[model samples]
Target: MLDEAEDDRDAAAPIDMLERYFAAHGWSHQRDEDEIVAKVKGSWTEFELRAIWRADDGVLQFLAFPDVRVADDRRGAIYEAIGLINEQLWIGHFELWSSSGILLFRHAAMIDVEEAALSLEQAEVLVDTAIDECERFYPVFQFVLWGGKSPREAIAASMIETRGEA
Candidate 1:
């Protein structure tokens, strides 16, 4: 959701900031140049090792990811991404019930998530985070009620019966 005008014109990429941040504390973010990959519940996530030689100063860190779509049945993917954000933020974990699509995430840790060409880890975490937060804030469950009828016909009948000649 971030734009070119944002980011204060003087901030490192969210990921790079994490590295520089740790470095100031004498912590080292060491990782193989190659990518670290993993899959959770059939959703693929990739990461690389970035270590801290010293404890972080609790400075605000940003993380971003571009657009990604998740299906309804794969709600667990949302929780998995939440765990990753918790790890990065050093915060309590969260639970989610992802329910929407086409999330436009802005003001995410001061990072423009949608604008970021995020890595797999970033993509997974962000896609899930946005979905989870939206669902938590606006919980809506919609389904068709059937009475031995096709869903389409059931919907029509229900609407007609409830309208009461309107």
Candidate 2:
């Protein structure tokens, strides 16, 4: 539900399911903190991060945190093309965690794509794909997922973060 350029130190003011899920488990060590801009209030163990990169070679990288996956805009134009294409779809913010409530992945997904479980490994691929996708559209797009095993613990942490959000 959060864009690739948005960052929240606290949990987003939405998604009751996420809040309830977290309370049910009880894993609130870090309130969604990462290396980025803007932190919201009442964050659990996960935070949403988003950023856009423009390279001198006419390349654009749209990256989102906590997953920190990079999407290569290798289609037409990274910003102009991907931004235009993304405008057509309805996006929503989604967070996923492990069974123990560790942050795994957080990003904007198409209305249809965000409603599912994604493992850490799969999330890694997603990051790779995002980077490659960005490269495809533009010329470059790379991302880094700060903090611990966010990529590996994404699915497990998401399960917990979702509960925390509840």
Candidate 1 lDDT, 1-166, residue by residue in tens: 2223434224544444434333433433453222211111212222222211111332222222223344564444444444443444332233342455422222223234444322334433443454343333211111111133333343344334244564
Give the Å error, residue 28, model 2.
23
Q: For each candidate, what TM-score against the reference? A: 0.22, 0.22
Q: Please, what are the lDDT tens digits per residue for candidate 2 over residues 1-166?
A: 3223323223232222233223333423222322122222222212332322222222222233332233342212223323433443333222222233222222332212233232333333434443333323221111112222222242234323233543
Error of 1 at 1 (Å): 32
| Top-lDDT candidate index | 1
Local distance difference test, each candidate: 0.32, 0.28
